[model samples]
Target: MSPETTDLPLTLSADHYHRPAPEIPGAIALIEDAQVGVNLAMLQTGALQIAIDSQAVKPGDKLLVFIDEQLVLVSLVERPCNGEPIVRNIPAKCVPDGIISLSYRVNVEQSAPLKVLVKTELPGGVDPKPEAPGHFLLTPPQLTPTTLDGGQAETVRIAPYPGMRHNDVVMLKCGNWTLPHNVTAHEVGQPLTFTLSPEMVASNGDGAIVLYYTISDAVGNRATDHSLGLAVMIQTGSATPVAPTVSGVDQQNALYLSQLGSQTVTVSLDTRAFTAGDRFTLVWSGVDRTGGIKLFTQEQILERQTTLEFSVANNTIQELAGGSARLFFTRTDAKGGEQQLPSREILIVGNTRRVSATEASPQQAPGEFAAGGS
Candidate 1:
């Protein structure tokens, strides 16, 4: 009833139609809603628009906004700047000739400073390589002999044992890190010799035999295994033996025995003066008292004095006619010296019996004289 009550149908798709305002036009813009459309006239006029629905713009996104009529652009609004929303502006006609490089500053905490490296690939497959730094290696020197006597003098030539040459130099290597050392010719031998300070010798002990030596090689290298070592030994004196003496009645009896029944014998010497290593000898000849020189006896005595004592006994004796016996004695020293005592001369007497004749004639004479007178 109002204007004949006739409603016209609206065509949704067409070449030209009414459209909403663009949320973002050429240049760049931040929008709260993205469901809006741009005017169809703006599209025909080469105007660009893009929709965005963001609480905050992200790193990569498109943004659009209108700067003026007949000018449109496409832009990309990356990250926020200065804590504010970012908008990148672009023209719609053609891309700008200048560079559109991006710059970003980020904060990263580090305990150490950052290191920078520039790598470049050379042509013809050539590449840069890291080089090693120069270094020094040290070695210990070697000595001809490792042992030396403390009693020797310094500055003597050094020579090793049997296999070593007479004039060969005993060298010590100056290692990469050490100094050179040398010894004189007299310093090396079966028992290498060297002069040691009195303080060093006394520290060990008086009259102690000490040995010392060091080893090295040519380079400046040093070795703990090749280091010097020392040894020491103390000296002592020799022992002596004690002398001995003879005593008591046995010694006297021995002397008396030597003097008995000996011919051309000498007096006995005292046994007390004898030393352990002394020696003695004796010789004797004796004749029995029976006037029988055919049965004469000869004797020899040999004596050695030692730490221990021993005795020899002879029981041989010859009996004479009258119950008398003859004996001989000889004495000897440890060194084979001999002496003999005089032979003993003993006397023996026989028992005697006496007989007397009776005088029968005397009685006869007295009787005869009386008869004759009658």
Candidate 2:
């Protein structure tokens, strides 16, 4: 053998090229080893250079390499590619977003088919398992903000990946509603899209819609469960407006007596219009579990958009039992139009050493700072 032929590391066992003596005389059969492997497995660029293990190869023994599922014959040379493994890139047709395709160029000197594998690594998400070459379907990636506004036509796109072939069936389901009951993966480079009909809009008060899907190949191999589902939120219209009020308490309706403590509260002004110089009063009334009530009231004139914190003196925390409170707001507009909206309820619990007397005290004067106004 020339030095060029010696460059490839022999991958076949010494016994692979040897055959046992035939029990029957005139039948001199050349039994090739069933075991198969490749040397110089790494691709230089896009091309693969490999050697065959069979000794029966002739000077013109034809060799074939499998790229993807397609086969291309390679010219066998006494000195292949000038003794250097040539590189080859995967075809542009095989490259798709979020997909990693593995193409193997095997030595088909023997008659059996060789296997290739494809894998995927989705950033910040599950890595789909590699699958053998042939028919396969990939699971769609997770969709963000699974919710949608109702009473309108909407569209959502799922990330694309390998193993998704044209005409593959993609089934989508959302609570009692299944549109395009059977859709196909038809476009390349573009994400799979689903259209939500106006009829799909959620009605009947804040109803939730969840989207689930499954992908199947023509031969019916489905992507594993791990990669097959997603969820969506669907509504017919804007959520009902919540009245301008206090919401989200950092501390549950409770006061701690350790020190002059404060809890952050969210003043939700959902859709409540305000004009300049509006005067607002927040009245907090807590009723002890036994029906005894303690009241705290504060008033503030509007300045620009403001930041607010709710605080209570340690002495104040000492005066309440576990119960609930009602928040009443009185707003006076620039024209002296006073509006007393419906009161909202808040919970209150006392974490003091003991429950203080429930006797009502005069509403204290408002504080200098925006918070802690009595």
Candidate 3:
């Protein structure tokens, strides 16, 4: 029952533990109230310390901690202290990028997979969830073209905290971008400002941007408090758009299969922020009642392409007839983020067109009616 054993507040998740290493993957079975959680403040300098309930597994079992699905850390269980509890430290690079999912294993198979929604890497001596991270009060929370002075730089005020001192680093994160600054001797215990350049603000794109700053004191302590965040919006024409524009057919347009032999539905998005290699998917829905084929879909761009000409085949159109179909396109960024526009619906007229029939009875030699009455 050492003080460090408190780092793991929860039990190892799976009651089952496999032999070790590769054998543990297929041996995990989530059972009962068993669980594992993160103690941010307890995170050591270079490794993750986990506590396992002595009653959960026997001594000498191996423990594995996976970060972001990669087996980055491993440790062997130490003997329990009179059934008090056991703490095992897995020495691996601890990174909380995006969303962090950490799981534990004993021996080969038993597992208690734990997913903690922590997005910051906190070093020693700081509360993982600090009451006040940095004095990050944005000068003007909202930004438009006029107020922003055509993408003029915006300033965020970061006041010194109780432990603020020189050599401490302050890092500001806006949307996906970050800006860093050093705390000067004169700035200690005084208000500091981080400037967001026009390009920096624009890089965050449109819509609400989460603004928060982390502090790494001279003593090497870091923490980010995400409970409340500064919400900033920049509505420039070139910023990342809120959603893509699905063009070609609108609700007012009723397509006739006879006329539109091959249909092309164009999707327009802000190419100003388009990143190559990102995937754009055209989701065509609302045609479940159509005949022949119930679903319709197409793919890709504009010059960003204005005349993208992503054509739909006649057979697809035939299947999509007899009902109104809606289309929306989504952009999947390289980081696996997605943004899509509202769906556009088009009414389809008539059933799927079929090949015309030709009657081929021998024609009476240039003349008479074939009917008996004649």
Candidate 4:
């Protein structure tokens, strides 16, 4: 038998129902990956609660999203709670200067997506660290005067070392205000030459002149505080005097004949005595002044002589005087040659003492004089 189709009545319960749609717009904030898992937050309102888990979010997580037609950002937030996602708002300007460390924990479940609006302003300046100060600021090259070899020069090259590159530009200046020449920079530790104009040379004369220079870097960052000044002196042609030579003589003589040892006889002379400015030498020797013996030769002053007299007591000449006695004398010539006189002998007989008298005679042969007579 065929069954007949039937319709039945259905009833609905109010206990099991869906939530109403949120009236306000749900906004999301964006943040950087480094900020994830750290404390962070974003500003928002309304019942559109934060959702993440079913959306798959975790601590230290990173996501790229848009923010209200302003700009897209990357953000990270602490772990979501239940099904809520955490979000934070970081200023774009703050991040450029330094990292904006989150000071508080952010709820990934309820907070909106991270969104940062960057405002435009004038270009920022560089700030040097306190520990490493900035270098001097140098400007573009300018013209300045330069002095070289005691003359003024219109052209000069400027250079810097350790911090400068080759073929850099530099400016030269005279005094504090006068600009003279713009020069090309060369490698440091090398010298540069500047040609002087007639007008510049005339003004500089022979006196030293001061010049200034500015050394710059390739990036246009100038360091003018290191300006240096150079002094140029004129060269003169002349010769210097040489030092003179010096010498001395010391000798001693005896009045009697006896075995002799090295003698230190005192000899003195005035340098001014020689009309020809000739030098003389004084010699001491075991050889007698009469040419009996020779020990050594020494140099003495020209034209001047000093007398040295002493006595020796012994059995040899004692029969002639009460004891031994003799006399000796030496004369030096302008050419440093020494001339000796005959030894003068004295005798002592009974109670009488006799002195031999003889004038120094170079004409007689050496050692030819009588022992007891002149």
Candidate 5:
């Protein structure tokens, strides 16, 4: 039989035990299935994985790799030198030292480049900090007055400048008036519209009012720009009476009522100069055949332009002693005082003969002659 086999002594067989490799210096080794790029190299060994600069080794060279200060691999350099980085374009908006997905289309003449590294370098002596808005105004303020009544409130809207933020405040500086309003809605780089209602407006020694404004940020940094002036004229007291007249009648002193088979005679009352609650009356006075006084009157409240209609019936016309009458218009204001317009004479006529002789010649009342004969 072969020589009897026996177990070796532990001290004599020490060379066969497993142990960690010594530390390696000056070079790093590639791992199995390693990937090399233009500027980077990835290595994996044992339980450790790491990346290193691939340009450290020339092609066809061997290198020793260290893992945790121990020599774990010895790999040969098979990757070729990388071509110079060719970046066609950098990202449009890049903040210094901020991580950004660089945008670029690169082309290399040599073997395909491996990794990409983007560096955003600031110019020397330049800072990359954000800044507050600078003073800017596209155009001056254009103010439009809503009303000129001092007893009523007035509204003014201002178009804001570009680069305005919602945190900005608008300050209105009219005579003896200072209004502070905040911007509720505004986006960066966009214009804003601000509206304000002032309780009272100042009169410029006269009856005219003016307004202006300034703009400021939340921190109180204001724009030193000036705005155009807004002017308004406040009307006080009451409007003067423009005098009431009969519609379609040119002459102020005369009126004619023709017989349309006792149809209603309608005349437009111009009450434009009057307001609500004013009172007025139209008076018709004449003499009856028996020497009795014949008088007709209608009262009205002024609302707007009004229409007044009355009947000049045959019975009413026949009662006049001379078939003649006089009509007058009167208006009363806040006080009971009255304002009477010029009087108009009436001439009565029948189908065949003249019931009353014309007191005023036809030339004196041309509008009356045309109206009565029609």
Candidate 6:
């Protein structure tokens, strides 16, 4: 007849004591070094077994397994005249997602937990690309000495992408720099955010840089997809801008919109280092005829040209009858490198009167058009 058997739980209890770790002895030992890839088909079939010490684990004793510190499996050990371990068929869904750990214990806590490496939840055909972000202007404080010393950080907002799960690890890479963020329970399926220090930006300030992000699920499965990229350039330091040449104004550098009629004020730049497909934006800012805040803007895309010309509408020119206004333009090169010119003060000596008339002839006086207070 078979000898009577004992019972115990893996957790600490009044009757249980710590035991040496279970041995995955013999051919079944391959389970100990399973830190490789997830065999989805095999896990679903429940063909795996837990090799145990026939002497240490008694009949009726409880066996337990955990992943990432979370309990996931529990089984009862039965006995007979056999050296084979109890084939514990753990369902695939029962395995908790984890990065680097999987452990088991019998009756009482084991001397140590086994290291298990399993990769699962790989994005076979799902989209892995993160949403692109709009361009951002770096504020003065962002480039201050505090930022350089790591005392300050620049915050970035990330729009939520499809299939985001809690505990997934997300990473952002720009040029030679990268940062990571862990997904929290409440942050799941919501817009995520991360930060980049000023030092990081300054290190990548050489030229236009492509930015992107990647995601790794909690199960150590890296998304099998390439992320979309956006190009941007960080600007710091200082550079003098060539004064903007304006046509359709009196000899006093004063604009008279009433006399100008339907004619527009043409602002031209001597395209320096300009190329086709380059984009230019012209902005006019100052007080309107009523002395209230006013702003006007225009955009132009260069095809193949020597000069960058941006025309100001007659109504826009007439609206700025507050004596003077500020005019400035920014150029974004084909490769995404951007250059901003300092604001140039222009005289607007015209009343709010709009009418149709002949166009004003071109006028140029490089020295007279010198940039003033911005």
Number of the top-ranking candidate, with TM-score as the measure: 6
Better of 3 and 5 by lDDT: 3
Q: What lDDT tens digits, residue by residue, belong to model 2 across residues 333-361?
A: 88899975434443333441221223232
- Better model by lDDT: candidate 2 vs candidate 5: 2
lDDT of 3 by residue, 1-374 (tens): 11112233333434443322221111113311222223333233333444545555655655555554555444555555476545544442354533355555454454545544332234222333322222223222222332232257776776455456556667665544556788777887777777778787655445433455555643333433211234444566645435334344433344555555565544454555566666667665534221122555665632343333344555655665544444556677778898754333454544432222232233221211111111
Runs in model 5 lying further than 4 Å from the true structure: 1-143, 186-199, 202-206, 238-374
- Could you tell me the TM-score of candidate 4? 0.21
**Top-lDDT structure, candidate number:** 6
Mark the regions of model 3 whose C-alpha exceeds 4 Å error after superposition: 1-150, 224-227, 238-374
lDDT of 6 by residue, 1-374 (tens): 12222353334443443543333222112332343334322343332233444455666766665444445556556554165554443344555444334455665555344454444444222432211111111101111222122235666566665556676676665444657788888997677766777688665433333344556655444543323334344445443334567786544345655567888888887765677788889876654433345678889988777888888777777666633455667889877889765334444554432221232322321111111111
lDDT of candidate 5 over 9-49, digit per residue (tens): 21212353222222112112331122211110111111112
Q: Rank the candidates by lDDT, best first.
A: 6, 3, 2, 5, 4, 1
Against the unseen true structure, what C-alpha lDDT does each candidate score?
Answer: 0.25, 0.38, 0.45, 0.28, 0.36, 0.50
In model 5, what is the error at residue 26, expressed in angstroms?
A: 55
Query: Residue 67 error for model 4, in Å?
Result: 24
Taking all chains together, each candidate's TM-score versus the true structure is 0.15, 0.27, 0.31, 0.21, 0.25, 0.35
What's the distance in Å from true for residue 327, model 3?
A: 21
By summed lDDT, which 10 consecutive residues of candidate 6 come out lowest?
132-141
Worst 10 residues of 5 by lDDT: 101-110
Tens digit of per-residue lDDT, candidate 4, span 1-374: 11111131111123421221111113222323322211111111101122222244555544322223222233444445456433333332223211222121112222233222221111111212211111122221223532233333455544333344333334443321233332244334444444455455444223223344444332233332223234333222132211111111101112212221222223333344233424443322221211122223444333333322222222322233111112223445556665432222111112211121222222211211111111
Tell me model 2's lDDT, rounded to 2 decimals: 0.38
Error of 4 at 338 (Å): 76
Clashing pairs in 6: 9-107, 35-117
**Deviation in Å, model 2, residue 218 alpha carbon:** 0.2
lDDT for model 4? 0.28
